[model samples]
Target: MRETRRQTFDEVDLLLDNARLRDELEPYRDESIDPSINRMPLHAENEYLASMLAWERAPALPIAEWFNPPLDLMPPDSLSDAQLSSLLNKTIERLFSKNIVLRCTDHLSDRELYMIVYRDILPCCEKMVDVPGKAIEWMCVEDTETWLRYYASAVERRRYQEERGMPLPAAETPPYRRQLPGQ
Candidate 1:
């Protein structure tokens, strides 16, 4: 009963939030997607609009800036193989703390993975959403090769074959497989 009541939207709050969202989103207004297609009730409609506003107004900052204690790392090229391995483990844990999960990573060496995080992932601009337990899985490699060889399920492989009419890569054990921290 308490949970259900908590989930119920307050009418006054809904209107206030919706108005604020409209104002914030005005400068970045894009009418590419028709809002009328979403037939949710008033409260839900406001939530959908609010989410859109969140993404629109989200600052393009480094992932380090997303955390209260900045997640700083040594330059990847400066580290030896052993140091890189240690830093990579620590980095993966820190990323998981912010619900950033690395996927399709078993194919790369420790240095390679760390370099990707330092060069590509950390500097990349993304929405720093604070949704609890909802992880954003970052695909670490170029999508097609690793995904086709290791990650894609049979159904997905068949769908790709049917859709693209291309030969599927044979599935193989990812060369550097090991357990990482859980999301």
Candidate 2:
């Protein structure tokens, strides 16, 4: 219940919590943790240790299973455009609730995004991290054309072309734009 950021080395709760976390993280210790955390205050170090332990313990499961009863979607072809759009919005909300974010989505149509969520995202196994504000950003677009055009800026495209020695796709407007969550 005290203020968070200025936590001094005097608090018993923090010290106790840190002790527990240190023991729990002993087996899962990263070689670089000591050097990275050496400069931080004990409270900050405790938080870092806890997050590392949380990630270490997180289960790799299909994203849909993060939902209670698991999120099962009907085939995108089975639904009309309006139906698909409505369902997609609701599904995005559900995914956001479980800390799963969809990125690079503007390039695809409603049906295309919906199918990706159904076929690609839901079944894909990912670490369900317990860390707050740490969401899994799932990329919705697979096409390089879409990435170069809508997502990347002209300068970035040019740099990418130079680096990869490949033709850059001309940048263009994405067909469908929605005010989706966690954009």
Specify the highest-TM-score model's number. 2
Residue pairs whose backbone atoms clash in candidate 2:
none
Residue 61, model 1: Cα distance from true site in angstroms? 1.9
Residue-level lDDT tens digits of model 1 in 20-113: 8778777877784357836767676776666676667667788878777777789988988899999899889889887889988889999889
Return the TM-score for candidate 2, rounded to 2 decimals. 0.85
**TM-scores for every predicted model:** 0.75, 0.85
**Which candidate leads in lDDT?**
2
RMSD per candidate (Å) reads: 3.9, 3.5
What are the runs in model 2 whose C-alpha is more than 4 Å off? 1-13, 30-34
Residue 73 error, candidate 2, Å: 0.7
Q: What is the lDDT of residue 139 in candidate 2?
A: 83
Model 1: CA > 4 A from native: 1-9, 32-34, 67-70, 129-135, 178-183
